[model samples]
Target: MIKHHEPLETAGPTVGAGAPAAGTAEAAPQDESEHGTLQKLKVMQFNIWLGGSEVEGGRAGIADTVATVEPDVVMLSESSPERVTNLLADLAERGLTYFDNKNPDDRAVLSRYPIIEHTSFPSWSKAVFSFGGTEIAAYSGHLEYRYYVTYLPRGYGGGTPPPLETSEYGWKKIPTGPITDADLIMRLNEASGRTKVTQTVLADAAEERSAGRLTLLAGDFNEPSHQDWDHRTQDLFDHHGTNVTWSTTKAIEDAGFCDSYREINPDPVLTPGFTWPSDNPGADISKLTWAPDADERDRIDFVFYYPDERLRLHDSLLVGPSGSIVRSKRVQEPGKDRFWCPTWTWPTDHKVVLSTFHIATR
Candidate 1:
C-alpha cells in the first residue's frame, strides 16, 4: 500500500543505548563455537513507503529506523536504485556502513558486510554475503499488490474489475457483504502471481541451502499468511469467518522456511502481528485505510529463514507504531505483541519485522 504526500515531519536527533556512536563500530560478540565462532545476525524486513516519500520526514525516518535497529542485514521493499544510494549515504553519515546489491529494481538487500555475489529476478533480489565466516543467501521481495483478495472478505473489491462484482468498489465503504467462500478467495488470491514469485525464490534458496549456506527470505508479500488465518482467528480481525491457506507463505512453509515472527509468537490470537495500515501520524487516515468501514489490518510483511544446524533464532519483534488503522481509525493493537517503537519518526506504512539469529561461523 502507498500513501499520498503529506507535510514532512521534522526528524530530531535520536540517542539510544545499543546503537554505536558516530564514527565507531559495534564490537562483535566473542562467543566461540566448535567450528568457529557464533555471531549475532539481525535481519530487518521493511517496506519504506514509496522509497520513504509518502510520509513527512519519511526519508530521515527510514535512515533512523535502520540506524536504531543496527541490523546486520536489511531486506528492503518498495526501494529504487536511487533510494538505495540515498540510504547508504544516510547510514554512513550516522557512522554506520552498509552494503547493497545495487539492483535497479524496487527491492534491494543491504548488508553490513560486502556482498560476495548477487542476482535479481522479476519480483525479487538476492544477495550472497559473508558474516562471521558464514555465507548467507538473502532474498528481498516486493510482490504485486493487485488482486488483494483479503479485502473481498471484508466487503471491498480486490481491484479485479468487471465480471467479478463486489459490494464496494476499490477501497470505498460500500458494504455489500463478506465473501467467505474459501475456494473463491484462494482462486482470486492465486491470480495475483505472488505464489509464482515465491516459487522462484524457493528454488533459488534451495540451491543456496544445498551449498551449505544459510538462506533467508523477507519482504512485503502483499498477502496474508495461512498460519494467521486458522480457526482461532477466523472470527477476529474482520476475517469474516473464513480460513485461507494463503499461497505465498504456505509455499514458503512447504519449502521448509520458518516465519521468524510467527515462530517466536505462535499464538495468533495473543500476538497477531499486523504490519500494514500502520498508524502514521504524519499522514491522513485516507492514505492508510483500504476498507474504511472494516478492519483491514494484516500481517503482509515478514521475515522467513530456513532452519539450519548453523542458525538459531533468538528473538523477533515488530518495529513501528503500536497503533494501526482499523475501520479507518488509528486503534492500538490489543494483542500481547510488543513493538519496538522508534524514538525517531516511523518511516513506512508497514511495520518493520526484525528477527535476531545467531549464526555459527566456520
Candidate 2:
C-alpha cells in the first residue's frame, strides 16, 4: 500500500542536516560534484524470506509485491537466481524490464538501469547506476547475519518465553521469564562473523569513494546498530541481555555510509523500523515448536548510501502490515504508540523497506 505516513523525527534539516556526532565517521561527502541536473532513484531493500519460495503466496506473491512497489533498484537477500528471474519476468509483463545478475547464492541486485561491473572489491559486487546522466557506484551486499546466542535452541532462555507483540511499534516487552545466556559463547561467535563482514564491506565502500564515485550499499545486515540500541532504548529491550554495538552497521557508519532509513527516521525509540520475523502470523515455524528463541526478531535488513551532495533523502517507507496478529497484545504503550502489520495477502516474513533519493548536480 502507498502510505502517506507522517514525516518522522523532523528536528533536523531534510537534507545535509549537519555534522556527524563526535567520534562518528562522516557519512556524506563534504564537497559537491558538478555534473548534471536533479534526478531521483527509488531503491528497495528486501529479504525474500527463505529464497522467496517459503512464503504463503510463493513466487507469484514475490513478483506481485515488486510490481506493486515498482522500485528502480532492489537489493535482495535469502534469494536465489531462479527467484530473481521470476521477478524480472513478472516486471517485464508490466513493461518494467529490470536487468540484474550480480547475485551470488543468497544476495542479488536487480536494477531498472544497465549495471556496469565494479572491480575494486572482489568479495562484494559493485555496479555503476546510471541515474539521470550521473554514474554512481552501487554496492549490493548480504553480510553474514547468523549470530550464535540468537540461533541457539530454546531451553537456553529458561521457562516460558516473553510475550513479544509484533507491530509497527516493534517488540513490546511482556512479563514472562528470565533472559538467559545459556549459549553465550556460541552467540558471541556468531556475532563475530557479522563483525568480520562489516569490516570487509566498509573497506570496499571506502575504495569506491576514493575513486571519486557516489556510493550506495544495500543488504540484509543481520545485525542491529549501536545507534539504535543506545541508552534510551536499552531499558525497553532489556530482555536482550546487553545492548550490543553490532559491528556490521558500526563499521559501515564508521566508514562513512548513511543508513537511508535511519537518516530519515533519526529516533530509534520512535521509529524502530523492525523488519525480521515480519511477524507474518502465517510463518512456518512449526518445526521450532520447542524453540521459541528461534523466532526472536528485529530490524536486520537495510538500505544505506554514502551521503553525496548530489544524493539527498526524499522519503522512506517501511512496507508491511499495520496491526497486531498476536491476541492479548498490548495496545498503546510509550514507543508502542502505533503498529503497522503486514496484510494477510503479504507473502514474505520480512517487511520491505524503500528509500527514495533526489540526486542533483549544480
Candidate 3:
C-alpha cells in the first residue's frame, strides 16, 4: 500500500537523532531493514508555491511540512531566498539542519548531508554527495510550463496557439472556444519543444553516473508525462483537442530514469498523482495578471531516479489535502493506494512527493 505522510502543523523533533552523524557523510539507518543489513535514504520533491510565501502560516507551514518528513535530500522548485531562509531556520530549530542549498531563490537543493560536488543550469541544478561511501547525484529541476501556449496568444509567449479555448482565461483577449485539430497539433509541438531543457539536464546527470553511485531527478516538470497520459487515460485530462505526448518527462524516462511514484503505483488509471492547482486559496491562477486555466490540473511534479539493483523502493509518501475535488472518477476514489488523500493541512498548491529507498551498501 502507498504510504501517506500526514502534514504536520508544526515541526516535530529530529527524525534520526540517534543515527549516524550527517557530518560524516554516511547513510542514515535503514528503517526497512528489519534484519539490519541495509542503509536507506529519504528524498522529497516539493514545489512550494512561490516559496510558500502566500500560505496562511507562510514559510513556517512549508518548513513544518518538510521537517515532518525529515528527508535526507530535498528538491524545491519556485523557491525564494526568504522562504528558504525561513525553512532552514525552522528545520534548525527542530534539530534538523541542511547546510547546503543551490540557487536559494529558485530551483534549489537542500541536503542534511554535505554536498561534495554540485552543478547547475538555467532551469536545473544537481548535487553529488556521498552516501554510504557511494556517490549519489540528486537533481532539482523546474521545466517551462503550459502557460506560454495556453494562456498567451500564439507567438506572443514563444508558445504555439492551443487547440481549444476551453478556458477563456488568458492575456488581454478572450480565447476562441473549442480549438481545431490543427491548433491541437501546434500546441503539442510547442509543448514538446519546451521540454528540451529538462531532457538535456537529465541526460547530463545520467552520463555522470559512475560506479558506486546512483542518480536521482526530482522537481516540477510543469508538464505531464507521456507515460502518465496514454490512450487509456486521455479522457481524464480536458484533452485540449488531442492526447499530447508530454516530452519533458518522456525525455527523462528515455534516459533510463524511473518516476519514483509511478514505479510503485504502476496503474495510472488507479493512482493518478495530481499535484497542481494545489486548489489552495492563494494558488488561484484567476487572480494572476495573466490568468490561465487552472481548472484542468495535472501531475506536474515528480521524483525520478535511475533504478539500480542495489536500491529497493520501500514506500512513497504523498503529502497533500483530501478535498479539492477533481472531475475525474479515478482520482476521486479513496482507499488504500488509491491515488492520494491527506487528512492534514497542505501549505502549498503543489503537494509533496517523498520516496524512501533502501540501498544495500555492503
Question: What does each candidate score in C-alpha RMSD?
Answer: 5.3, 9.3, 6.9
Where does candidate 1 clash, by residue pair? Answer: 8-56, 9-56
Q: What is the C-alpha lDDT of each candidate?
A: 0.82, 0.56, 0.61
Q: What does candidate 2's lDDT look like per residue over 31-146, in tens digits?
A: 34464565556778887776555655656556656665556778877776777777777666645568775565667777777777643232255667665556677766666542
Clashes of each: 2, 10, 3
Q: What TM-score, to 2 decimals, does candidate 2 have? A: 0.73
Model 3 spans with C-alpha error above 4 angstroms: 1-37, 146-175, 180-193, 281-295, 325-345
Q: After superposition, how far is residue 136 of candidate 1 from its true place, in Å?
A: 0.3
Off by over 4 Å in 1: 1-27, 161-168, 173-175
Report the C-alpha displacement of residue 258, candidate 3, in angstroms: 0.9
Per-residue lDDT tens digits for candidate 3, residues 144-178, read: 65444432222123233345342234333333443
Model 1: what TM-score? Answer: 0.91
Q: Lowest-lDDT window of 10 residues in candidate 1? A: 1-10
Candidate structures ordered by TM-score, highest first:
1, 3, 2
